[model samples]
Target chain A: MREPRFHEVEGRSLAYWGLAALLAAIVAAGLTAAYFMEHIGHIITGMTNQIVWGVPHVVAVFLIVSASGVLNVASIASVFGKAPYKLLARLSALLAIALLIGGLSILVLDLGHPDRLIVAMTHYNFTSIFAWNIFLYLGFIAVSAAYLLVMMERRLNSYSRPVGMVAFLWRLVLTTGTGSIFGFLVSREAYDEAILAPLFVAMSFSFGLAIFIIVLMAAYRWTQRPLGGAILERLRNLLGVFAAGVLYFLLVYHVTKLYEAKHRGFEYFILGTGGIYTLLFWIGAIFLGGMVPIFLFYLARYRHSRAAIGAGALAIILGGLALIYDTIIGAQAYPLTIFPGMQVSSSFYDGVVNAYTPSLPECALGLGGVALTLLIVVSAVRLFRILPENLADIAFDLDPHEIGATPNRGALWAPADGR
Target chain B: MTRRKAKRELDAGRRRFLGMAAIASFALAPGVRLIGSAQSSSPASARANSKVRWGLLIDTNKCSETCQACVSACASYNGWKNEGRPTDPQWIRKVAIRDSETGLARTLPVLCQHCAEPACVEVCPTGASFRRADGIVLVDRHICIGCRYCMMACPFKARSFVHQNLTDQRPQAPRGIGTVEGCTMCVPRIDAGKVPACVEACAREGRGAMTFGDLNDRNSAIRRNIAAYSTTRFRADLDLDPSVQYQGL
Candidate 1:
């Protein structure tokens, strides 16, 4: 690849300018809202005593799930020794780190005592799922960053491969832990399904692969880089398989809930009055997130087209968001029946029937999280030149007798010292 | 015959004198050292043996939703601000419950059940929440770290977090922002040998909706009521063995 060199570029691109403006507006609105919340308490938001956690929580979960998804590219390429995926591995790592920070930001804003968040780490509640999630998320972020650093430093390419694997495994466990936060609440009854954890795992992979393909296409378009056709095709096929798996799991999860009949009220809400959530799950998540992506990848021409890849990526992201929204909202839609044979009339104002709409401030904060993620990713990309601009010309084979041998092995691996 | 009558009268007089002397000694026992010692020891022993187990029995069927007397009494006694945004200082609240099958509803007053085996007590890392020997559960807000795990662990949703900054909080209750709180069964009242605010309020209304007494006392009205009428505990399957029992509804 002619020994990658750095050169100062001219004025910022139009895309960067647009992103900056959007970010500024979002941050300003979020700050104003946060100030109001701090001064007046959570009453400024739609969240009431019954609905303690509202839209910010949903948005936070969505970002976290997507972040976990972003980890799959590195897991597939570096840890699993998938050669075709290696070209996009660095970009995926950056996205994973970025999205996690975004998720964390949204979560902090949602807390009643944002200042007391450190208590989550300081005060350990072994039995509380929320406490466990706090630790798991922190661990995931740490391991992911370490692995990314190892990759960036071009250090211990061999030993760090296992480190990447460890990171990947940890993130999968973390994602499952997040899912179990809702799933393990047996008292809630609405979220007692055992399949939610595995379902989240499937989502992580599907969303991760979808994001990888889209980023790869964008990187190629912007930098005039050309990733190998063989690699792209392999990724598209894997994504199709993952999308199918996610769809299957989602279907089984719902069917099992219906069959149990105990949580029928929750099922009714998801399949009935939870119209928007139901549509998002069925149409956005299943068809757009799963079927459409799979179909696009199946067609030879569509798989290679930038537009098709972009559309598939957009669908997967939106679908992932919808799934998270469904999990959180669906769990709370039904009231906890303390008395058997007692029916409570659902009201729009209080208790189980409490409705929530994200205020402008909450939406702005969510947008700010997205902006922050992009800012981080773009800065990292600018500083380190993480993404390989010429994937085909970069020699993967290192041995003298190999057809694509390169003499750069010492340069890449020397700094690691096998530590 | 005259001699026999005189002898009988003499015997009766001697018996009456001995009985009067015994009565005088008993009345002056506190002044006599030996008798005083005996009386003091006996009363002290009785005091040492006595223990009070405070509890409440609520008749949900007879409870009137219209009467806020209990809430008012509790607030006034505890010096809780009853106006504005109802704060977490509410020790007792009337929760309106609806029938899941019939959609028929009734207002039921819910307070801390004061479970014998409280999950909140078990989960408090700082030991801020504990069940007393008298069977009342209380949160020592002074040491509370404001962790909401107790809230989640509680089956009855009995705990509430204080959310606003505070000044001049009542010394007896002493609640502040960032502390979990629940009904105390009016521990202050119990110590004074008076009925809890809710029980007194219910009694005053002549509905007999709430009865408070020493659960350990078999003769207590609460104990008799619970035995006479069928009662239910919220989420009894959890096996918390709650101290509070509800009747009729």
Candidate 2:
């Protein structure tokens, strides 16, 4: 593989401006919602002393988890020495950074004291996982940016391998830290399991790849560049494997919870008794999020179809979001059993499930995070040479579908334009 | 009491200073001398220390189901009532518990246990939730980011996030928007050598069901009652070493 040439997308079109404007509007609404929540306090939202974290957490965690997952393509190329993925590394790194910034913005904006971010940064409680995550997330951004630089600059090419290795390790730890935020909560029955860390890693892999495929395909299609069948096939296959891996982890987590009689109530509540949670866990997270995507990828006819692959990716993304909702809101809805074998009732709503219906402000704030992610990605791509030119014709040894087909080497190479 | 003993100790040390003739004349003439002196100062002015671990013992047998003296006292003391809003902060509350099989019902006032190993303290991102040297767990609103991680980590569900802006906060217990609040075990009163407001209210109601004292003192009434009766900590299996104990579950 020769030096991969990068190109800047022509971002001055009506469609481009319109999309950017729309996303910016959504972001503005989200900011406005955050302002109201902060000004008036959390009384406007569904979150309470019982269900402390709400939709914002779901949105933020999904974005943060997916951010770490988005870098797997770069890791595969730079760390595992996959030639095909090497060309796509820059875009992956860029997406990771954009998604992280967007996710973190929602998280910070939703804070009770968004103004007190300085206080959070200045005061370091070394023992808290939340404090540790602040450093991990910031460190990931810095390291991944360096990784992108190493990939983009020919002069720094020698450092790319080591830097990529560091980024891969850091991302693993970052996702683990994210998972442990809930995992280490000893007071909650649904958490305190060791599986949550690994479960998040698996979730990141699936969610990240699904998002990467969608972005790659969209960028290629909108720019009139051929995405080719080869890379898509490999990505589709990897996505299927990751979806399966997520299912395996889910099974292990549920089984582990079920094995302990003490945790049985929680499992039953989420699996059977819990109303909306049960539906989401079964239909949204399990069936559509995991199984449907896996099936779409495995079917020979649809596996190579760009539309089917995109659909699969979209399903996974939606599923990932639902999974987060199920985990976060669902877990909180089930009342904490503070007292054993006693029917407890109090003014504080003890022993009764807490109700949370997402308000418009919460929806705005959460969706604002999504729009912010897209805005960053679109703006960044327009400003930088992140997207590879003519990805369709890159000849590689592992193109299973094109083993005997002649490589369109001369036809594929295009000069960098619109710099 | 303890203040009298401390004053006596200060006077004994002051006697050595009285050995000097000039100082002796001034010290001996109590009615005419030594204004604003430290020897007669109350022990409550002294800083809280580890030598005493303040605790509460609640006897359910003596507690009446209809009474909410402790809860009302705590709310008034903390100033957390927000027009009876569903999200209003309740530092202390009465929980009505009934056995599922036996159908035996009882009422108990629950608040922050001030655990030796508090889950809220451990999970606090900014160390805002902290246990004092004397084992009073409190949230320093100055540093609290209002992430509410402590609310999730508290086993007793004792913590409340201030959902709205607060006004006219009591000088003793200052609260605001977006900070976690909980039962402070009446630290300000405890520091002033007075029992917690809830305990005082309960006793004033002629129940005398609640006792607040230093757990480390062997002769403390709480320790004596624990020795004489079987008192149980809520969720004792967690090994939190709760300072609050209850009799008659």
Candidate 3:
């Protein structure tokens, strides 16, 4: 394809400002919630000594993991030399940066002392996995930014392949580090599995692309740029494969845990006896997040339905959040085995499931991170020539549905008027 | 007196066995004397090197579930209160453990293990969680960012995050908002030539079930007791080499 043209969206419309204003309000509320946490303390939240890391952690991990995974499109284009993904590369790199910033913001703000961020930067605990993550996250952001620059600077275009290769390798390590954050925890039953590293990589692929498709379609539709059905089809198919990868990893992880005599109680607690956790694992992560999305992506009945595809992406995000919560909080709820082959009871809530009802401030703080991510993405796309001018030529030629169809012109994300 | 009761009688006065000269040469050199002098005189006092490794031995047979003097003593000494809520900080707490199959139950007071190779110290993003030369795991509040990753790493569930702002912190245990705090093994008291508050309470008011001494000194009361009896560390399979060992499971 002759060098495709790109341009900034005309963002002065009421829809654009209204959306920005709404997100800004949410961000403000989230900040207020963070202030309450820092000002008052984590006591206001549902987290306790038992369930130490709470809902905010779930959101932050989701965004951070997805940020690393979102680079796949750019990697496919530059690293793997795929022409179709090349057109989407710029947006992919931009989204990765925005998502990372958003995730990192929540992580820092929710700290016991967000003020001591400088200390985290200055002090180096070489042995700590968490400390290693600080470097990994910063490196991923820096490398991805340079990759974007190489792709944008026509003179530096040749460097995109090498830079993209570095980014791809860095992303793998970044996701592994993220997974190992939980995996290295020898204490907890649910988080100790070595498979969590690859599981998170698969999760990142599914969650990142799901969010990418939603954002891509929204940006194109709102700007009245024709998004070809071909790209969406390819994305949905890839999303299916990625989702299956996550499911496969999870199955292997669960089966192996079940095989262990020591881990049986924890497995049963999550799969059966644990109330909210069990519900989240079965209904949210397994059915909606894992199964429904896969079916929506592949089934012929919903194949051409843009709304179905959008819903599939949304489900993956929600389900991924559920999985994060179940894995983190659920394992914590089960008491640590202080004595082997013994049941322990304590005022510290031992041998019994710890209850956690996430408070408003924790939810608000988490939501603020989401708003911040969207706001960053929207503002960046508006300020820069990230989106292609039109995918009409590519779509009209390859996508049978887009060949003769007339869209309603004012629709958001799809031709959903009568669908 | 019964052998167990006779041991209880010796528990309180065992520190006096080390001749003052021996005490001055051994205990005071690496621990109490230098740490005490550091607090009273200047910050430049000699560092407590690895010559000493403080440890505790608790006899579960004497630690009754109904008595919470050790817990109360720790709270009173540290100026923290257990509000009975899940979020409350329990520097040291009582646990009632029973065998799953045999249904044989026992009571024990669980606190910081002060592991020789602490998981908390290993995972802290900042080097806030640290082990002193004398084998005490501590959180340096000034450096702790409160990520609580250490809590996740600790096998014993021995650490607690200060969930709320505090207005009632004692000088000996200076805690504040947002930092992770746990049983310090009464570092201040240890430096001042005193046994930990919990151990003292267990000796004075309760069952005299606890013994504190330098583990490196084979002649020390704790090491002698462990050598004479079958004692085990919690989660010994992980091989963390916790300073705290227990007897009579």
TM-score of only chain B in every candidate structure: 0.74, 0.80, 0.81
Quote the lDDT for A248 in model 1. Answer: 93
Residue B137 accuracy (lDDT) in model 2: 91
- Interface RMSD (Å) of model 1? 4.9
lDDT at position A400, candidate 2: 40
Enumerate the candidates' DockQ scores in order. Answer: 0.09, 0.51, 0.60
Q: Is the docking of candidate 3 incorrect, acceptable, medium or high quality?
A: medium
Best by DockQ: 3
How large is the interface RMSD of candidate 3? Answer: 0.8
Quote the positional error of residue B169 for candidate 1 in Å.
5.9
Q: In model 1 chain A, which range of ten residues has the least summed lDDT?
A: A410-419
Give the per-residue lDDT of model 2 (tens digit) for A209-287: 9999998877876777655666776888899999999999999999999999989999999899888998899988998
Please provide, for model 3 over A124-179, each residue's C-alpha lDDT reduced to its tens digit, 9 standing for 90 to 100.
79889999999999999999999989988889989999999999999999999999
- Candidate 1's residue-wise lDDT over A1-419, tens digit each? 24433222221788756655676667667667766665555556655434445577777777787788888878877878866556566778878888888888777765555665555557664655666777788888888888877776655556568878888888888889877766765545456567888988888788777766776665554554444444555566677788888889988987887887666766787777776767877787777888788777677656345456567767887877777767765555445556655643221111455455656767766777777776676566666757775554233322322322222222221112311
Give each model's clash number: 5, 0, 0
Between the candidate structures 1 and 3, which one is better when assessed by DockQ? 3
If candidate 2 were superposed on the true structure by all CA atoms, what would the RMSD be? 11.5
TM-score-superior candidate, 1 or 2: 2
The worst-scoring run of ten residues by lDDT in candidate 1 chain B lies at B42-51
Q: List candidate 1 segments past 4 Å from native.
A: A1-14, A17-21, A228-230, A299-301, A345-352, A392-419, B1-56, B71-106, B111-196, B212-229, B237-243
Using lDDT as the yardstick, the better of models 1 and 2 is 2
